[model samples]
Target: MSDKTSEAKVHFRSNAKVHEVDLRIREANVRLCQLCLWRNRKGIGFHIAPSSSSLPVICMVESNSPASAGGLKICDAILAVNNKNISEANYQQATTIIKTALNTKGRVDLLVVEQKFYKELKKNDISMISSSAKILVTPHSMPADFFNFPKHQPRTCDIHVNQDNKTFGFEVVSGDDNIGIYIQEVAPDSAASNAGLRKSDRIIEINGTYIEQDSNMNYQHYLWIAQASVYVDIGDDKSKLEATKLFEFVLYENPLHDNARLNLAILHFNPSHVHALETCAIVGLQMNHPTEAFIDLNQVLHFQPSSAPLLANRSVIQQFLDDNRNQSC
Candidate 1:
């Protein structure tokens, strides 16, 4: 028994060493890129979302931005900025770190796990999605039943305001051809702003009733038809030509789903809107995205350091995560 135990211990130690070496090699392979952005002028021009327990992901990289020029891509996990560890930082903290690095040095060094590697990690585990890739709005597998529905239901969010004014500080405009209401502005320090309302957010519904449009056809119908058309392989040349034509009509013309985009947008916004973060965390938990929930909870704790409820909720999430890890092992 003693000999077997000793052998097992030796095997464990060897495995640990191998893991450490692999990690070091992976880190070394991650391209160390640099970018210079004017201080307080224009941002690095990328948006980030919180991961479950690892680095925040690059959700959006603007075209022609410093981050874009620096070879940053969507779904990249930002490992560090200027040697400052961001692996465990929340979205706000990661952005702040990058901004500070840019302000102080006029240039920032980023260590990132590129999208390809991140996708590989995701394939190994579902929880890895939070750490390795941006949350996609659409599912990889589209259900055939989805085609039966004329349109998806609009999502409504109730945000509590603890201020004197009851107004949600946002302006709306009719979408092109009066399709839906589009958020035109979100006033800073207002309830709407705190609720994570953004400019250009299309409001499909308010309270419960769908926003009516003058157009008889729903925009989403066109989008749905377009997506469904891709699978119309009738094994005939004429049918294939028709499918191609249908695809052309819907290509580059899909109306964004309000729910998924809103969830992502709110979760990614900086300056950490406590109410929005709390709501987002609840949504994340409901969606089985505990990593996203944990990230939001951590961000809220940063603002409300002494809130018992937040701390308790975070403890629950942590426990759940621990349980998940143990089960996975």
Candidate 2:
């Protein structure tokens, strides 16, 4: 039994050493490949120095993998993974070997290096090795979807306060993580929709500040600006902030249903905003008063006669009103 235990200890120690070496190499390759994927998506690439002291180049990426989608070609040498650098001495076999092992675990890391995209292979600064590194995957295959990826740009529009003094407009931003300000579908009769706000119009900013970049300012900065500018104005609620808190609670109850907060927020800032006028039209339509909706639609048309969507909506409302009038007549 003592002899058997001694043998098992030796084998375990040997395996541990091998795993350490393999892990180091695999880590480097994964970093390189990940960076390559990012560069491809962003239209940029990087350069690396090949030194004898560096880790061995890991398993070259096969073409047609996610890395290849990012333009990594076959047989590209991996140099790093996830920001960890690798050298020729330690990583050449580390990546694939690690990948094979990770297949059992369902995940693996890779670092890859390749000839500069479309450039001739170059010699290492020290050993003059022709660098054949390439990341064999694309951005979509990164372990984490958000790793090293660029975010979508914010969307903004021009609020024509006057012919020459237009101010930038944005949708009311929402959500945690400071990801973006989304103008969920504009309410048909809300101040925003009535003022020509369209669905999917990403609210980028009010006056050029990135309110979406910080969760704390989504309401205070951008929403406040939109309301103040009369683009969205409801009525002066001296305790509007408190009212909003209550509104948040109400919204939380439904969770998925659209809340009245957006419309109310705009109205709170600019009660006379034309968009608010359209909200009245929507209410009229819901109440079976097509004529009332037509009146509200006409009120907005008086402001923006050339708005096509509004015109279309108005035409539909007008038809409804005319049919009702005929019935009444």
Candidate 3:
């Protein structure tokens, strides 16, 4: 068995050769490519970045891994998975398709083209990928890396529980990034801070137990369904946090989903569908996480620039941050 707790990503990449890809085209200019990977419960060892308008492109492949053995290369634009055309799929959609196939089938067949070739086709306004090709070009909703990753990379913090304190001095919380739970509010001079657990740093595991990607979506979706999209008890802060994890997982499975985005935010128990950033700016502010509040407000403002209430809320969060900075100084 592989040395992995789950197939969920938080991992490695490497370099090999182009021999892993089965070339469908004869010319170097030919963009069509293919890769059939044998996957374990863990995952095919590779990372894909959204490129060329939301198309999943092979960005990293680990050495001695299924993807590397299968001949997947960086910049290979994924066209379809398991023979389904995803020429127009966003990063979330593509990931969902891939995850669904991997979970049910235990193997994945990918149809891809080199990034340069896809760009060439786009440059010339070629939608039809040759009459023989299986995938037809679709319009792009993802213009680029809409998922702006934080400046920091994932790091391991070796915080030993103090014998006296017996606490790591941090709280775990789920946020918009569907990756993992983050370390919230590290106490200075405590085990977590001494080990470098900064605010917003994702906690990948605890005591050697890896947190898998597959989490129950019941709190947000099932409850919403049971009530016919109405009347979910937002019981308490802990309950809301649990629902937040559900929202993250649901969003992970389908980024374009309105329910995961909107319902959780506007859960005044109303029936009408909603969608505006993650849960709410007020929720983040109430939790005393100004950065998150700002992000939520910023996301809403991007779509509803004239929303006065949202703008006012953003101003409040901004002022709070400024005051905090001055205090620290």
lDDT of 3 by residue, 1-329 (tens): 35473332333221111221213232323333333344221456567775446677665554334554454555567766766777678888898888887677655767666666665444321233433344322112211222232344656677664224444577543433343454435677887778866554555554444553413332233323322221234345555555566665666766756555654655443222224353566656555668877987787777778988878878888998999999999
Candidate 3 lDDT at 307 equals 84
TM-score of each: 0.31, 0.22, 0.29
Better of 2 and 3 by TM-score: 3
RMSD of each: 26.7, 20.1, 23.3
Q: Rate the local accuracy (lDDT) of all candidates.
A: 0.58, 0.45, 0.53
Segments in model 2 whose C-alpha atoms lie over 4 Å from true places = 1-237, 255-269, 275-295, 306-309, 321-329
- Model 1, global lDDT: 0.58
Candidate 1 lDDT by residue in tens digits, 102-153: 7787777776666446544333322222233222121222234333423434
lDDT of 1 at 317: 96
What C-alpha lDDT does candidate 3 achieve relative to the native structure?
Answer: 0.53
**Candidate order by decreasing lDDT:** 1, 3, 2
| Clash totals in order | 1, 57, 4
Question: Which portions of model 3 show Cα errors greater than 4 Å?
Answer: 1-24, 28-41, 50-52, 122-329
Ranking of predictions according to TM-score: 1, 3, 2
